[model samples]
Target chain A: MTVSELAQLDDFEAVALPEADREIDGAYSGDLLSWVMGRARAGNAWITIMSNINVVAVASLADTACVILAEGVIPDEEFTATAQARQVNVLRSGKPAYEISLILGSVL
Target chain B: MSDALSFHYDVDGESFSSAGQASAGVKKNLRQLGIDPEIIRKVSIAMYEGEINMVIHAGGGEADITVEDNCIVIVLTDRGPGIADIDKAMEEGYSTARDNIRALGFGAGMGLPNMKRYTDEMNISSVVGEGTTITMKVFF
Candidate 1:
């Protein structure tokens, strides 16, 4: 599923990007950085509440297909810029991380 | 061998937000070298866990990754309060991290176990109050 597909799944508003330019393969949700780093599979879309720029590093390390900032919070400008430079699709949703995860579990 | 590529990283425990930089660099390097995506992911995750542990518990550490023909080796060495009980530390959902660390979305106590899970072999040497060293291998 692409980011566009995920947007069409439920009531998850497209807050960040209009559509993902890359293909999404799996879904993972976790707040724990280390656990997510360990279990989050490649080509998967990551849903998290973390706003730190290090999240970009973790996402790159995991080779995630994209990242969805589930909480309705904006990250620092550096975060978005770096993500854009890497071509790593980053999205933000108004729903909390858990709610987004539930929505993803049902759709994905 | 001697011809294998090696990379060394200094893990800075000062900033929790910059914890995974080393692992990210390694992942990029592995990808550039044409390592299998699965193998790269495994190596990256394992090393990332180690990197976070060093920052959260050990006040910082050093990581060394060596890429051989058939295996990738990761060595993490830290100088902090060592593990008092390795067995307990290895158990799932057991962590001694402060509550502040938890608020940062870590301290789930899964770092060591995850490291073990992703690597083919894991060995730890720790001295309580002195330091700790972990060696992990992923066979390709």
Candidate 2:
């Protein structure tokens, strides 16, 4: 499934749209940007509570399809803007990280 | 042979928000140069890990990237309190970053290992009070 398709699901809310629809091949749950950068797959949904601008950078470097901010963690405007500029998808979810991971795993 | 294309950047120590700017810029440059996408990703990730280290441990530093026909070389230099043990520092899950840094989604102690893992070659030189310089090469 693509990031846009996943975002349109009931649990996720799209905060920023990527320049294109990147396919979601997998999912990774981590708050450590460095760890995620080193471990996450190219087309994964990065599930995290990190709402900082650096999150966008890490996501871009890891080539993750989208960043899902779980537990309704809202990123600042600057972060979402950077996400848009970087062509990264950002999604907000009210579910916990584990639940989001499960939901993404079942679908992707 | 002709000299390789190069770019230099000075990373600001105070801004976590801007830590990966140099790497990001380098990635763009590599893309413009028509480097292979896989090689570009490796070089960018390795350089980015170095930049984060400079910000978290060295109070910032300078990054120099040289692109050659066969490989890309990155040199990162910083003058912060140096690593006492390179071996330990290279270990995963051995971070010395403060709790605040961890709160910012870093400090997982995977920086050096990740840098080495993504690159073809890695070297480190440091003194206790002086600073550290890391050289990494990623093959194109």
Candidate 3:
């Protein structure tokens, strides 16, 4: 599923959709930025509760399709701006990371 | 060395938010140079981890990237409190980062190991009070 399509799901809300049409080939769930940076596949929808600016940097470096901020974690203005500027797609969901991963598994 | 492309940046350690800017810039430069995506990923990931470590452990540092014919070399130097135990620091689950840093999703004791994992070669030289210098290379 493409990032835009994932944004349409009821569980997720679009935060920054710079690369909305990017394809999601898999999903990776992790809170550690270093772990996610190394392990997450390029097109995976990275599911994390990390709302800091470093999240955007890691997403960009890993080339992840998008970052799914699970557990209703919302990014501050600086993070949103950086994500948009760096062309990193970000999404927010009220569900925990496990549930978000399950939803992504079902679709992707 | 004469024909190599080099880039240098002074890492600002005061702000965690800006820690990865140098890595991002290097990634962009590598992409523009048409380097292989896989190689670019390895270089950037290794450099990013080193950059984060500079900010978390050291007060700040300097990073220099040199793209040579056969490999890309990254040298990170920091003047903060140096690592007294390189072996312990290289361990996967050992970190001296404060609790606040851990709250920011780092300080999990994975920085040095991850850097080694992504690069083809890595070396560290340090003095406890003086400083630390790490040199890493990723071959093409």
The TM-score values for the models, in the order shown, are: 0.88, 0.97, 0.97
Preferred candidate (DockQ higher): 1 or 2: 2
lDDT of each: 0.84, 0.90, 0.92
Top TM-score: which candidate number? 3
The clash count for each model shown is 0, 0, 0
Per-residue lDDT tens digits for candidate 2, residues B1-56, read: 28789999999999998999999999899999988877888888888889998998
- Which digits, one per residue and each the tens of the lDDT, describe model 1 over residues B14-33? 98767888997898899899
Give the candidates in order of lDDT, highest first. 3, 2, 1
Tens-digit lDDT track for model 3 on B1-140? Answer: 79999999999989888988999999999999999998988888899899999898888899999999999999999998899999999998798988999999999898999999999999999999989999999999
Give candidate 3's TM-score.
Answer: 0.97
Relative to the unseen true structure, what is the C-alpha lDDT of residue A23 in candidate 2, on a scale of 0 to 100? 86
Sort the predicted structures by DockQ, highest score first.
2, 3, 1
Q: Please report, as a residue range, the 10-residue window in candidate 1 chain B with the lowest summed lDDT.
A: B16-25
Evaluate model 1 with DockQ and give the value: 0.66
Each model's fnat? 0.72, 0.72, 0.72
- Interface RMSD, all candidates in order, equals 1.7, 0.8, 0.9
Candidate 3 backbone collisions, by pair = none
Cα distance off (Å), candidate 3, residue B130: 0.8
